[model samples]
Target: MQSVGKPTGSLDPKRHLWVLGLLAPASALLPSQLVTHTGLAFFWWIGPIIVLIVIPTLDRLIGDDGTNPRDEDYERLSNDRYYRWCTYLFLPIQLIGLIIASAMWAGDDLSLADKFGLAATLGFVSGIGINAAHELGHRVEHLERWLAKVALAQSGYGHFFVEHNRGHHVRVATPEDPASARLGESLWEFLPRSVIGGFRSAVALERERLGRLGKRWFDPRNHILQAWAMTLALFATLTLLFGPQVLPWLLLQAVIGAALLETVNYVEHYGLLRERRANGLYRRCSARDSWNSDRLVTNVFLFHLQRHSDHHANPGRRYQTLRSSAQAPQLPAGYATMIVLAAIPPLWRSVMDKRVLAHYEGDITKANVLPRKRRRLLAVRRAVA
Candidate 1:
């Protein structure tokens, strides 16, 4: 057994195998049934209980085998083909869950709380699970990319395909990036900014991308426009077929999913900054640039999204094979706990600001100044008050 924050070079094979054993079946079954079986309050309780008790305990109890990072097995598993297959498996499973959820919502037998719970569950799974698909979607394969878009569409966030790859990636962890939460910004504050800001940026980026190819902003070939249209069409179809009631439920699900996605963005780089050179260019991103989480449970459920530092460094890496980096910023807790903590702005700042300080202890040049900027901004607002 090892401590939660203990440093180990490679993943714990026992923990990894346990995750593979538990998660693959749970992922397949949970989202589909949680919503569909409205009579079962037990299902909802079961998941949170497992997450809180079983996963965390396993994380602590499992010991790591010291495998060298340079091992051929690690190298082979980390390659593109593994990730591509993972992407293929992800899409159909998600679509089936969404369809089952929608069917449950269409039925009149379900209670209000059941409906709300279903929407919430759908939002979590769609936002987190499907967002993983979007990450894989931007890679150099056509099938994987298409599957990613389909997963995004199920969540009604298909524009992420356009925005995240072409827009957000290029501007990540910068002031210009909406998805990048600024220092001292609460999760509540970051939500509107990320959603509205990401949407606007995606449109702007689409126009720019199209212009380069001598296409108009509203051109049918523009993916941003196409995605937006598809999203609206899906909403319209849901509203028409299932009646207007389903529209609110769908929107609620979308909002929940979007909030979860933004909260993730908030945690990943929070206050991290890249230095601008005298020539007014920021330093290029490296493996050390983003926060990484290697907790076995979270990694399997989120498709190794916690290996964010690697993803940022090598944006094309598939989720299955993303590796934990020695130099990356690490999270104290899993994404679920982190999301809850981020809701309280001052607490999040108090905790994460210390992390920023620790990560930059020796080097002032590497300090993320966004927290300072936020402090100054807050002081000015208080003075006006």
Candidate 2:
């Protein structure tokens, strides 16, 4: 009922019920994967149907709810055990769902369509799985940090823990950040750069940390390598239990999940650049540096990740406490819908390029536009002049 982008003053702490959508993927997938074994053709399509179709449609119909938790409620809401338990419980559910999904993939009863839908479903769930990791990974508690690595291991993106924390966050919104999408770079171009560059950045960060401690790059203290070891163990165990065919499905789903992560990276800071100081260091990050979305559905499902600007500014802020700012650039749609739109390069540019241009009030040079599009953009400016 609230208008998209309009503030819905002070939210009730009880509204944490929105996170119930986090359970939807498991409910959709576990049953579908199991029921398909009974030769029910319709169940195979359920996961993709609910995630791709149902959620996105509802996101549109529901629009945004720009409600910030009242300051007095911040401590109570942030420290809520129920919120933490919701995320804590996701770890086991994610592990179990993966096992069931893998077994289903390895079974011969599933048709190609069934397997395809399952893989898409796994990818969809795994993307949210990484989001769960992202939330826990930021915490200072030992259990939460380890849980983050465990979640990342599910999608074979364990290195994300190191790169995102030590590397990407340190260099976000600058040319130095591979995870930050440059203006005019399509999602296809951004994906390889983010994925490969992000991995390399993680390795370098870990290698540096080890060097400071006079240890080898592959030292046991290296958290990045530790995460990868967990991934290898997960794959090996799954293979031994479910046969070699399950390995490909796991890998495919991992790629899909990783791509989904990079897609978020692409959209979050697209075309936003920090000011380079005379000393050559970029200005400090603020709410203005990242794109913000307040759509309630995806925000709840992803744990308020849509309020990215506040998260970037205060990395340790619990998801329940992240607030939206009117000054931060707003996305045209929630992440799920925007991610699908980002897949089509021309349509993405047509819709988003003008937004980037508008954000800077047509100061094209202020954006991180790629070299290939620079000449054309300049020509367009000249023609318009």
Itemize residue pairs with steric clashes in candidate 1. Answer: none
For model 2, the stretches where C-alpha displacement exceeds 4 angstroms are: 1-14, 24-28, 31-42
| lDDT (C-alpha) at residue 216 in model 2 | 96
Which sections of candidate 1 miss by over 4 Å?
1-75, 78-83, 236-241, 362-385
Look at candidate 1 and tell me the lDDT of residue 364.
Answer: 31
lDDT of 1: 0.65
Superposed on all Cα atoms, the candidates' RMSDs to the truth, in angstroms, are: 4.9, 2.4
Winner by TM-score: 2
Quick one: best lDDT, which candidate? 2
**Residue by residue across 223-306, what tens digits does model 2's lDDT show?**
988888989999899999999999888988888888888998999999889878999888888888898888877787888898
lDDT of each: 0.65, 0.82
TM-score of 2: 0.93
Instruction: Score candidate 2 by lDDT.
Output: 0.82
Q: Between which residue pairs do clashes occur in model 2? A: none
